[model samples]
Target: MTDTLETQPLDRAPATPEDLFAFLDAHGIRTTTVSHPPLFTVEDSKALRGELPGGHCKNLFLKDKKNRLWLVVALEDTAVDLKTLDRRIGSARLSFGRPELLWETLGVRPGAVTPFSVLNDREHLVTVVLERAMTAHELLNYHPLINDRTTAIRSADLLRFLRATGHEPEIVDLGPPSGS
Candidate 1:
């Protein structure tokens, strides 16, 4: 008899918020999600922060001079020197990626960018940058593929999930460059 069962391709289909939860469960990563009004800015999210314990993140979807893409996940209060960030990540020069590209590559809108979105990047086109300090925290919070909710998970589990999605992120000290 021939083996006829075919496994589904993991990266072919875009992942939705629901899919993200299933992915987390499959990886045995425990998470807590809190629902609230859509948050587009850090200030807007502040109201919900008090209820959640852990480090909150602000994710940036950026592109380099060569058109290489990067997803930067940093602590909400961390001061990121964009002009000097390229030196650490080794990108030509960096600027926020176009909204269209962000959606297409990460399957998220502007306010919804999160490291979890790497699951939608079947081609693994976007490089992930994680702030070292942020990862040191016990728990980290980010949107679960959507802006209307926040999901909190163990910092280490976040890395595990990213690796499971084929994105071995570059964990760097996001401290401002010395000369900056």
Candidate 2:
């Protein structure tokens, strides 16, 4: 007999930034986006993002020893020590996922990792982790599947979007940076 799982078809093509926006609109999730020079780091973003107000964020794509994947979304200034985070997240030792793995799973490059990228993970392979403090902000800003723009959405709307995409994110209080 043939294995039913093995015979299943692959996931559909990944969603583009436009597609993501459309999805949000269809769900009645309001958002605002600003275009600017491509930003590859938090420092770059801070320097160029004039007066945008919100809890700007940084995303980490990680892989644990057991090969499980995680997407961590936190405030740009938050210090995420994988050494301690691994324990709190209940995972084996965690390390940065490779560029290829990031692309394969999230359909985005290193500089464009965002909670929005989870739109591309149709198979639900990554567990999303939201920093508790970050969620306290009224609004959150992130790249919209690309590095050349930033999008702002409500904190409640972010949770709404993630759940809409089949991801019930884990909200964790990743307390102060070590030795702060």
Using lDDT, give the best candidate's number: 2
lDDT score, candidate 1, position 149 = 92
Q: Write the per-residue lDDT of candidate 1 for residues 1-180, one digit (tens) a residue.
A: 011101223335568889999999999999999989899998889875567999988999998877788999999888888899999888889999878777767878888889999989877888999999999999999999889999999999999999999999999999952354
The number of the candidate with the highest TM-score is 2
lDDT of each residue in 71-103, candidate 2, tens digit only? 999998889999999988888899998887787
What TM-score does prediction 2 earn?
A: 0.92
lDDT of each: 0.86, 0.89
Q: Quote each prediction's TM-score.
A: 0.89, 0.92
* Cα lDDT, model 2, residue 57: 91
Evaluated against the true structure, the overall lDDT of model 1 is 0.86
Native-to-model Cα distance after best TM-score fit, residue 172 in candidate 1, in Å? 0.5
Residue range with the least summed lDDT across 10 consecutive positions in model 1:
1-10
- What local lDDT score does residue 165 receive in model 1, on the 0 to 100 scale? 94
| Model 2, position 25: C-alpha lDDT score | 100
